[model samples]
Target: MSSSLLCLVFLFFTIVAEATYSPGGFHHLSSLRQNKKASKSKPKLPFETRYFPQNLDHFSFTPESYKVFYQKYLINNRFWRKGGPIFVYTGNEGDIDWFATNTGFMSDIAPKFRALLVFIEHRFYGESMPFGKKLHKSPETLGYLSSQQALADYAILIRSLKQNLSSEASPVVVFGGSYGGMLAAWFRLKYPHITIGALASSAPILHFDNIVPLTSFYDAISQDFKDASVNCFNVIKRSWEELDAISTKKNGLPELSKKFRTCKGLHSQYSTRDWLMGAFVYTAMVNYATAANFMAPLPGYPVEEMCKIVDKFPRGSSNLDCAFAAASLYYNYSGSEKCFKIEQQTDDHGLDGWQWQACTEMVMPMSCSNQSMFPPYDNDYEAFKENCMSRYGVKPRPHWITTEFGGMKIETVLKRFGSNIIFSNGMQDPWSRGGVLKNISSSIVALVTKKGAHHADLRAATKDDPEWLKEQRRQEIAIIEKWISDYYRDLKED
Candidate 1:
């Protein structure tokens, strides 16, 4: 359609979006599409109104001395009526652009929401530059960049947006994936009144101890690997034995990683399901971790296997090193409460992903090597440092601390404040909400899909799959509209 006609359609819908929320006061957002359209239009105003570009309004800030930044995107909502007066926070400390500006991936949520979409560059990266250059230079300064601090920033922006976006307080929705899931759950808990609802998907909210629900997750991954890979388990078994002897050395990762690149155990053929965790585990392995009574870093997969993956997808150069870089970043750094391992020391076990849990933990190392060839190359570590890192950094204050997960503390806060919660997850999504619904608060509803990968379950890497990913996102938007209706209209129990 013509640009002029598109604008008119958007304006007309903006007014209708509000009424859609309260039709008959029934709490049934999922079924609201069946309801009739409201007979109304945005009122004619005396003053000239200015609208931001349909695209996102991006901004950044520097608050510390490490390697992170605070960033948010002002996403225009697709409200048929001018009802949304607030912003929606995507899960965790992340680049809000993915939720707002990355129109392609954020499929459903970004386009239609008229309310601003705020993406907070995690406290240490992107344009939300906190602390100056060399912020990640040491662990002491990196302490300021934690989940506690990032959550505080989420609240700060909500208030700021309310004042600037409009005088009226906009009902905000905290949305996100995996680590973002943690952010969404906790944000609603702490600032229940400020946020209307949260769409927390595939979040690891329950503590590591609560991981029992997903105990089969690793087995599921290993089984898939073994099914497709020839003697993959034997290779890993050998690697573990070797690690038994060398795993104690703090500086041994370099030597082990070299061998891992060529190890046959690592060479196993992974299926679509294996792709989820094998990819994610490799990322944590790159850093260091001690998990499941193992004493070795993840055995490196086969070089040919890694190479085949890189070849299947297009690349800027042949040097395309690791096949699992994006998966690694998504699981480890996930932008929620980012933790750095500035200086790693090994005990009985070498480095592991579990280090983030220890109160005495230091920041993760941020050398260009860890994130250089990261996918969506626009966010490589080099760019991360250039775009966000600030000068003077502050250590985290106690107030910045976040709540833990014995219960649906975060989701509960959302409903207490009168918000309808919707969590979106892919049934096969590995690192995210693949198994989160059973443990979440009953008040919150999850939107589940079967054929998704990570990040709302679309396959973005394969050659013939981008189109499929796009169509999946389109479907997600319609789901969001339905959810809004269910919350605002059908489930009036609130």
Candidate 2:
């Protein structure tokens, strides 16, 4: 392989390794459900990797439109009968295959509806690099990796796919979780002529702008532990102060290294500590009723399990030791590493690309605070903007997402041009507060679950699923069926 291809492969594995728990460092959705007792293994859906145009801009405003093709992987299970709807998953940050494999909900329902299943890779992520690995790191080319361009890519891809397959009459229903979920809903809103409806799960559409509180993300994580056990919350609360105290002392860095079993001595970078703490955040997000492999090999009720450890910590042990032990449940689950290395978290070629994305368009305003479980760490806009500009040479657009896509004004837009989009959120998810949680209209609905974590409803039906999830999935299936029927009925009228 060429150096660029080698870089791509290295990045791919790095993301997958982190994805054993969390990918992209931003909030993600965990799907794929089976019965509590029935662990139905997901069969690999073979997909051919294809490429599409890079410079989609037709206005010819740029110096010269670079003609290039980006990769997109898809799986067509041949389930579609004549005129059956198409099920398209709007891929998020990471490889499309990961989303395709974990999201069994689409596959399960595809066979039921005889729908065609396709997973489109997000540009700049996975193997869909527009400029290859060389230009990928260049700030000039990174400007094209915005969500607007991505949605356009989906629109163009779907249009071409329909024409090529001669499935013009077939209605398309988009499905996605997290960032992709936001894309699904936005795609249906912007390109309704292309897709009939969208199922957006755990999409923080309103997380941007001043629409939702900035503290909502960490607050939700804190609540997860509090719900699990107040003792766990207390231990975590004290652990931050303990870690801070230890870090501030003359010998604090070395002490932390000893406590956390760091391979190298603790550095001055706060990211090391932040990384150790982030494991808790991941645990809370994927705290499913059953063990999940979305981010890591976490057991069912991971937050609860971690709490059990904190609640049983030895009375004389230092809070730092307790925190290390708790964090070890996540970072050192396999107990394979000789020492904890913070470099493993950030030092990756693929993660470097994701960090660029986070620095630019995907400026998720997440932070920690004394109000939450962890210590108060402000992520003020000025600092955030400065960091993005310093790192990516592009200023962070705090309100651009809402300005371009209609944040709080989404309700009015949906009421006017949007319908058949199910905005689902789990109450436990911090990202849920930023999503549409109530009915915007009859067809535009929100499905909120008390036990659902992140995009739990997007997972395949599981025997271990709570009653509420079972009902939620049933309602989603029914809503999707109605969307297809309504689309066909309207097509006949046309």
Model 2: lDDT of residue 333? 57
Give me the overall lDDT of model 1: 0.35
Cα lDDT tens digits, model 2, 1-494, are 01111011110111111221122223221111111011233346655557766564533566555556665768675687757788999988766776776688987787889998889988887778777767777787776776787888888888888888887898989999887898898898888889889999988888666577766776888898899898778778877667667667988777767776666786653534555455776677677787766655677878888888887877766776666677777765555656666533332113345555555655556444677887655545675566556566887666676677787777787688678899998888767777898899999999998867878877766777778888888999999999888778888999
The lDDT for every candidate, in the order shown, is: 0.35, 0.68
- After the best TM-score superposition of candidate 1, give how far the Cα of residue 365 lies from its true spot, in angstroms: 20
The model with the greatest lDDT is 2
Residue-level lDDT of model 1, residues 127-175, one tens digit each, is 3434454444454544454555666666766676576645433456666
Deviating ranges (above 4 Å) for candidate 2: 1-44, 53-63, 269-272, 346-351
